[model samples]
Target: MTTAARAPLQLPWRTGLAYGALAAPLAFVSLPLYVNLPHHYASVAGAPLAALGGVLLATRALDALIDPALGRLADRLFRQGKGQGHAWWAAVLGCVLLALGFAALWHPPKDSATAMLVWLAGALLLTTLAYSAVCILHQAWGTRWGGAPAWRARVTAWREGATLIGVLLASALPLWLGFDATSALLVLGLMLGLWSLHRLKLPVAQLADPVAPSPDRPQRSPWANASFRWLMLVFMLNGVASAIPATLLPFFVADRLQAPQWQPLFLLGYFGAAALGLPLWVRAVGRRGLAPSWRAGMGLSVLAFAATPWLGAGDGAVFAVICVASGLALGADLALPAALLTGVIHQGGAGGQSEGRYLGWWTCATKLNLALAAGLVLPLLSWAGYRSGSTDAAALQALAWLYAGLPCVLKLGAALALWCAERHHPTWRHTT
Candidate 1:
């Protein structure tokens, strides 16, 4: 590395604010797609439950498979000197797809089942593809120009926090303002996204060293990097746990708690707490290091999930507290993993050079977690004799077990894996 190219790293505040503003939308879009889409399709389109699930399952699975390739494209684009503009393009495309997707979702085919399936598949695939591309590019953009651990942490915090704010706002917009308002909120979000894109000061790729891959290694599959695999394994496990409740909370709240009206309260508490908790987790990251703090958060989640089954009907207050605690734990989930992965990228000799490829795979797993939650778990629960509106004690019990116990089991696995990863220094020490 030449001295000129290795000049001291600095944080760009205008760039950070722009980046943070862009995150406001990314955060809102996913929850709606994963959590609300099913109900929306069922009610608005008159689509059958089985067929709707099948379309979402097939299309999203295909979308997840393509994310790595998209990430690779993003990497080349980033290195090709477009900088953060790649994300801007991806965002524009995402916005277009998402708008079309939502509009289709709002007004389905007259044939009901057939048209709904076709529209859902095409629109979701397009929307998911664009969503994945923009998200990967955005993370890569921040990492490329982020400079240091502290700056990267702040960048991630601002983005994730803003994302939570979007989630909270979107939660109310659809309920309070109606679908028209919902569409308007999304359009507003896209505008902020573009404006933020304009605000970013994308760094020039100064290092002559290659940041992308050979033609043979398109997509830059980080799977070949053994350390990344270890980190991914841990990440996937924990992610599934987090995803389970996110996907099922509506069902559980309505059926088990018998209080569907409180759904907003639950989501608000969870996301709002996560936003507040980010700074505290940042403090923990400073004191205990990213790895240790992450493990601690997982432990907190484990305990929280373990305690979930004890709550009964009219337990909204208790559950709200649970959401707050779990979201507090979520702060670590959001902040540390990326920060730790940034360290991994740095150790893998990537960092500013190859964050897109590295983050692409990370983002891939992240999406799959949601896909599995919605596509796999819902059907599996149905197969197991659990229905959303069931008054049967046995069926309701199944919902609780899935909503809490399963996530607890996954999180426990993650905590155990984290312990082993640290002892083995699987990714960290190996890369070192």
Candidate 2:
């Protein structure tokens, strides 16, 4: 094992907060890109749903495909001489590009359909690429701060908790402050996050290694690890389940529920609940261990989502309850899997050496899930005769089923996969 992997982590709450600060802004940017952008273009910008789906699929798929290479770049930046300095500069560049791309994405030229589509495609590519670079670096950094499973869960909790805050802000701000102000806030949040990271005391000896790869000790690829593959299967299935709801949330709220005004409230309730429930999940991790806690969360999500198809207009209150329930489950989704993956990396003897690569593929699955949700779901909805503001019973039913029912099935599958892994693979038990 590497010295860095063996080093004990002494993460105080203050340092954990500092280390996780950047996640807030990065996630702040993510909510709109993933959740709101599709609705915006389809409804507000008058873009054709099928074409927009095509664009999102192409750009996001391209974005996901390149993550492994970017992960390799991150490894080089961390392994080379003056590694910390190089990584810092890379993050700075990513932030700057992120800010610019975000602005462009939200304020696209609506001169013509062709122009808008072109602008949206370009902007999405730039924003997602920049987001991936910064996010992979941040995740890799956290993974490098090696610790016991419980400690890793705490680190992930801090980061994911801040992420929920960012999600809450993103959910509320466009409604309260408008998109222009929201964009400005994102830039400011990015700046503040970067500043906090600047003040953070990194594990310099761990991250700033100047060693060149020895010919005899070739690095292992993340794909070569069986545990990573199994874990990613569950992660990707679970992510697709989550992504479907996110993709369809606005439409469900606006059309099916006939409660557009309540969108912000629903969003706040969801993410607020997630943020508040993080501590509970962290404790669960400590007590029950990562996989069990994650399975429990999946079960909770399935139970919450099962009631959605029965809901209709004026059932916003009941839906809010569902949101809170599902959001609590979201806390587990956010914290535990990543923690488990950190354990997987260390156990596989990758540790500080290949954290970026593992997390890169991790992030890649995440994007592909979103991409698949948007690319397939939107076009499929359109094909099924469901428009954004439709009140047709069949159409609304389709939307509800896709939004609610599919996720439950997928979540259950993920839970089952996790359970089988636990039963079959003893290494999975030790990863915690």
Best by lDDT: 2
**Per model, how many backbone clashes are there?**
0, 0
RMSD of each: 3.7, 3.0
- The C-alpha local distance difference test score for the whole of candidate 1 amounts to 0.72
TM-score of each: 0.89, 0.94
Lowest lDDT block of 10, candidate 1: 205-214
TM-score leader: 2
- TM-score, candidate 1, is 0.89
lDDT by residue (131-161, candidate 1, tens digit) is 7877887777666653344444666776777
Residue lDDT tens for model 2, 32-77: 8888899999899999988998999999999999998888888888
The TM-score that candidate 2 achieves is 0.94
